[model samples]
Target: MVEAVFQILRAGKSLELIMSSYELLNEIEKRFPRIYVSESSGNGSPELVVIEEAWLPFMVSLDVMSSEKETNRRKLRGLFDPNGFHELITGLAEMAYKTNSQRLDTKVCVFIPLSLTLQPASKTTLLQFLGNMLLFQYLVNVLEGDFLARISMYKESMNWNFLRECLINMLLASKRVNYRVLMKECLHTICGLYQDYAGIRNEPDSSDEHSSENHNTDVAIALLEVQRTTCMAMQKLIIMIMEIDMSKQQANMLGLTTRSDGLRIPLIEIILDELTYYRKILPRFLQIFNDPKWKLEIIVQYLLKYTAKPVRTRRSNGPSEDSTFLGVLKSFSDSSSAYMSLTSQQQLPGMPGCNEAVIDSLSLVEISKNVAAAFNSLREADKKIQISSLGKEALFTATMIISTS
Candidate 1:
């Protein structure tokens, strides 16, 4: 069914085929099916009824549908509803987390191929949903370059929250949707920007291709400055999923712990790959997030847990053959031993006792261990060409404690 629709859309014909598919799925089935669940009290299980078959292809078609019609700026303006696309993106990771509550132990990410056809959308909301998800494709690509503040209208429409919401969803769903292709492109772009930053920021012997790529020093600086902050905040957002797992004790306050067994391995891999690959710029950029206002401990803990194991990229056909960041990720992942040797962790004064304390204490130790490992990785990785050279000085005081120990 999808193949036929894709062919029609690909041919640049009218959206007749796609619309017919939507209407067919939209039709209600007459037969009522029953489902049952056993009650814990030993009473008879309750039977549940669903109105529609919830054809998933209908939902997947929305992406292509919107892309076909979203040529005008005004067409997408109506998507900014109070309880709509914004929340969908920001809350998707958490939702995926809960939906697979029983399966997190297996390292299965709750994020799945979204089936939007099941949503109870009014005609108004349906259009909004289509336009919004399509817009996500452009926004993710935009962040890869210096397009943020270039246009006055873009400045008015997009803010930190907006970007954060979309990117978070994109990261989780990149393996499933149109987001995958574009995000891979965005990663490539960000990697190049990091390369330019590296060559220009360092003294001679840094490759000419790097510094020469962005001949305008001021533009390169501007791009990295914004890119760093965005990436740090994005990292914090990704780390929060793991933090949500660790904070299962406070499910009521955060309203995010319905299923907190743990983060899935795939999600962890995605986060680790980005964080590891961008270690070139992240350590310096991370200072913005280190302000006491944010939860730096969780960020540190996330790094330790995911990067603890070496990144093993399976050989594949296309771009995987020579990605610059893949080598760095593998190197960082292999340094787990250097990270595990920290013997003691400093206790924070006046800390509360409870689940919060457990998470924080674990966080402190993880933070301590990662800091120590980086310094060690640096001293050694300098001799080896693969380790990132960005963050050695970022953890000066923390590394000192390990050295003295």
Candidate 2:
């Protein structure tokens, strides 16, 4: 029944059918959850109960993927295998990029060829795009439901197995999925949609040649709402993956993770690498990837990559005081002595001391400028962002340093 509803959304036959099926699927999932907590008969304690036979939107298991017939059946039934999931996000990312670049008409049908279409191409395109958006939205909803239930159980049991076996983990672990490419696509899709809806990028031009103005206006409004929600759903998916990574790290620390848990690059590191390579997305990513703890950590790490010394002693287990945000702010002092204090050990032979001093001064100036720009970006991205105590101190330090400089 759920798969039938999903098929309706995938078919993109009509707006009314898509909306109704989407709502019905969500309601059904809510009422018949696959995982939940139930009280144990013996100890009156709550135990995590997973209905093994319950329907899931994902078909990520190796056994299922290994059988061609079974995989085909699942695909026919509208289940998202890992490969299909990656392809879906990848397609969305491409669509978003094209839309942002003004190369792709958002109201033109992407799935159906114009020559073979029975209906008006523009209207078909609009409905198809809306369907894809809702499809991704629903998938994210399912993932969130499943992950949150597992996380709740994990908190009580400290069981790595529960998370290790989650649909998301299983999906990412599949050999058919290119984890890095998938993650990069997700980041692209989120930032592209965010830029479009946030007015940073121009809206796509409307096509009235193939559809009526009234129809276009209605589709435009619907697209706007669904696009915003789709962006939020993408953000939620990223955060959930990061949460799972954090839990896996905790499990490893406790020696609860075994070889069967398998190894995967942490999502935070993947995001950081992507942001580093695609510098244009860094500010937007920092703004929208708003899990405060992770956001702060990413910002600090990003700064340290540019400002900190190239190497640290083996005995140093963590970033030293000089490598911290406060330390970076302090380095912005106008005094050459303050600058020299941070880099004196790296002085080279055959280089004049004055030349070295000039280079270090320029470096300090650049770092300070970057720090200021990053803070400004954060503020621009979110006007209501609350600065923590440490953030406030760092801000104050930067202010004083700027005044003096």
Q: TM-scores for all candidates?
A: 0.29, 0.74
Compose the digit string of candidate 2's lDDT tens values, residues 1-405. Answer: 777777888895778888888889889889998887888999998888888898888887743445688767877888888888998998788767765222223342223233334544476676777788889999998888889878888888999888988888888888888888899899999987777666522544456664453454555556667778899899899888888988998899999999877798877777766876789998677666767666765665555444434345788796344444544444433234234433454422111011223334555445555456555555554567676775677666766666677
Error of 1 at 120 (Å): 55
Cα displacement (Å) at residue 37, model 2: 2.1
Candidate 1 Cα outliers beyond 4 Å, as residue runs = 1-176, 198-268, 273-356, 362-405
The whole-model lDDT of each prediction reads: 0.33, 0.70
Task: Please state every model's RMSD to the true fold in angstroms.
Answer: 20.9, 9.5
TM-score, structure 1 vs. true: 0.29
Determine the C-alpha RMSD for candidate 1 after optimal superposition of all C-alphas. Answer: 20.9
**Highest-TM-score candidate:** 2
In model 1, what lDDT does residue 146 have? Answer: 18
